[model samples]
Target: ETVNGSEDIDTSMDMLQRQKYHHKRAFEYISQALKIDETQNSEQKEIAINLYQEGINELSRGINIDVWQGTGEKWIKAQRLHDKMQTNLAMAKDRLNFLATGKLSSRRPANLTIMNK
Candidate 1:
């Protein structure tokens, strides 16, 4: 809501660039967190998990951000908007639900058991 030059920003390229920047940052955090194991009696792994969670939150912001697709061949952009919005919205909703409840949803099967003989 407060940034210099933001008042003049009104382009799909700008939106895509911002999205890419956020994605890059989130990926870095995720990669850093992925290299550590929390079960080794090390505090660093816990820190890493926290960092990864934070990165995921940031990634969600990027996914939720409004992006105005530029004027172009309307059909292509329309298809992209439909698919992209569905995927992004689903991810955001799934994360929010998971945060609220430990499980993803009741419909997800919970009775399946892996067995070895």
Candidate 2:
């Protein structure tokens, strides 16, 4: 029982690390996408968008895996990471919309406008 319990914790930790990695890579892709003017490099923008979308899919899968079995702290940490990923995903979506329409999204809050930068 002790060994099994330890293994579960290890698996949970690994899942958390994987999720974090995906989130970081997504952020990088989004940053690159933001820097490139879609009019100048539409291909690169599309690639970045695809890469970030892949990352988002990975993060979403990790979130769906119920790995937070033991402590509340683990759950809280996972939730925080999930929230950050959601924010990044939203930014990516907004960027896509902006690039497609050449207009900023009016739905985004004022505070997030600053944070997106």
Candidate 3:
């Protein structure tokens, strides 16, 4: 029983460690994406959007596996980060679309007139 317990603990730790690695990588991708000017910087913007998509994919892969079985808090945090990455992915795609079309995907006005208060 003791040997089996040790193996279980080792397996659980390994899973948690992998999840942590995934979380860190996803955060990095989002950070890079945020630094890019997806609206104007055409060259870098494309790279940034691609990074965002990669981040979303990383999170998706991590979330697919069960993790943090012993610690509910860690599981919840990972889940939240995964959800946030999904939003980031959608926004990046929108930015990419806007960059290609010179207009927002939402179809907002292209020119904005400054109004005096």
Which one wins on TM-score? 2
Off by over 4 Å in 2: 1-4, 37-70, 108-117
Whole-model lDDT per candidate? 0.54, 0.65, 0.65
lDDT of 1: 0.54
The reply for model 1, stretches above 4 Å from the true place, is 1-10, 38-41, 68-117
lDDT by residue for model 1 (22-99), tens: 667766765666555324435574566566576676676666556543344432454464455456445544543554
Q: Give the TM-score of candidate 3.
A: 0.58
For candidate 2, the lDDT comes to: 0.65
Tens-digit lDDT string for candidate 3 (1-117):
224476776776687677677778877886777678635566786687687677777766666657535545655675675566567656656765665567756533443323222
Least accurate 10 contiguous residues by lDDT in model 1: 108-117
| Model 2, span 1-117: residue lDDT tens | 234577877876787777777666666665655566444676676675665566556556545655446456775787777776767666666766676677878876896878889
Better of 1 and 2 by lDDT: 2
Which window of ten consecutive residues has the lowest lDDT sum in model 3?
108-117
